[model samples]
Target: MADLPRILVITDRTQVRTTVENVVRAVCKEAGCTWVLLRDRDLPPLERRRMAQRLREVTNECKAKLSISSDAQLAADVGAEGVHLQRVSDIDGVRALLPKGWIGVSAHSVAEVRLAKEEGADYVTLSPIFPTESKPGYGPPLGLETIREASAIGIPIFALGGITPRSGFSCVEAGAYGFAVMGTVMRASSPGKVIRDYAAAFATSSSRA
Candidate 1:
């Protein structure tokens, strides 16, 4: 529930142009990404844990926060800054598992956002504000209205999906706390630039608000 950075870089193994670890290293080296989530859901637990360990080192070297998606045990084992939940059913159980960890969850609808708030999610990412290549077939784009609606519910709502510096400010204006992105950062030749651009936009928009 502490102040999370305005820019969050979500790492997906399947979406990277190069190796996942290399992408993380390059992005962090660029110096704009404040938090990075290791979110490869298909990898076996051992492999995921290994990748998380490597990412933790990268985050440490860059003085950035690192989190593992959907694996509280591994997050605790790796001493991550936090754990994000995608499919966890019981927040109470997760809270017990991660007593001191920062928590975030994915919310698709306003109802889900309220549920997440009740369940004690520190933040929630409301997705598909625009069409996103990283996540296809999940559903149609939720649009900026989802962010606007969720913002009224009180949890810090992060807009995810097809976010860019130009479009990011629209999300902030619509009342999102920040942005979470994957494909844009993953496929970028200069991920640092992308992050810096988005961060700048967020700062300017937040100031105006």
Candidate 2:
């Protein structure tokens, strides 16, 4: 696969509908970060599908890939590009539910990452390269060394957790294939500019490397 973009914007419908979705979409578009993970833990099944469809419509306009979280069937039904499995156990089940071309799991630890790779995940997310607001009480952030170790496992690793526009480039420098964000963009004064800055920093680093 071509080098993925430096950012993956995750949208939780419960947390990111209304204004947040607009801001995130705008930011991801400007940054050329073309992958989004749409997640909503509170929505009813029907509502979740509806929201997924809406997200697909919005993301497609920017030519971004939309990956629904936890619901492979719904993702396929709504024409999403993939599904993000939160746990290793869900990997085979979700894979069997979707067709051949969709994306799969992202694990947080070395063992889980290995399992994800073994299970045929399209990519994996290793998190908390620094403290993050989205996941409180998830223990101290894993830091760059952990991310680098996980990245060496030979699967694409998207560094997640507490990754701000300022620290986003550090994740890339540490060998993360990309970064995934929730609060940084949602909480930004200008989400679009935040994305642009992160992307620019990653591009600059890429050129220097």
Candidate 3:
């Protein structure tokens, strides 16, 4: 897998007042975001593929990477750099389908993270790191300590759920390789600024380290 970006922006068109394409363009072009995970699962397959293809063009124009969530076939069809799978997904199946492509898995616990690593996932998004209105049923926040623990398992961990620009450095300090944000950037009036802030936070953390 290629070196993963420091920020992974998950798209949710319903949460955005503006168009998803506009936000993605802003983040990729202005904020220098290198990775985008298309997560509009509620859309019909045809519609979702159309959206993915559109976003792929935007990302490609900005020299960024695009990953389709839970859809290896769509990722392949649209020439995405990766496929982000649900925890219950068959990693091997996706591997066979997209042999050279990146594979990211959603993991809620250290056990799941370890399992994902064992199954050859290139990275994992460990979610509910803080109280998130976006995924209330994910239960309580996993806290920074969990980030520390999960990162020790030897796979890159992207802190997810309720992650904000302000909290980016904290997750990095706790050993997270990056952050995965949805609602924060999706609902932002200036999505580029949010992405820039996240980059700034990571930069600050690196300087301190």
lDDT of every predicted structure (CA atoms):
0.83, 0.75, 0.91
Question: In candidate 2, which residue pairs get closer than 3 Å at backbone N, Cα or C atoms, i.e. clash?
Answer: none
43-65 in candidate 2: lDDT tens per residue? 78887777788778878888888
**Clash numbers, per candidate:** 0, 0, 0
Tens digit of per-residue lDDT, candidate 1, span 1-209: 44788778888777677777777777778755768888887898888888888999888988888877888888889989788897537567777877877788988888888988987888888887888777777778888888888899998898998888899999999999888988988888777777778888767885886
TM-score of each: 0.94, 0.89, 0.97
Find the 10 residues in a row with the least total lDDT in model 1: 86-95
Better of 1 and 2 by lDDT: 1
For model 3, which pairs clash? Answer: none
Of the candidates shown, which would achieve the greatest lDDT relative to the real structure?
A: 3
Better of 1 and 3 by TM-score: 3
Give the per-residue lDDT of model 3 (tens digit) for 1-209. 34788789999998898889999999998888999999999999999989999998999999999999998999999999899999645788888889888899999999999999988899999988999978888888999999999999999999998888888889999999999999999999899998888888778987998
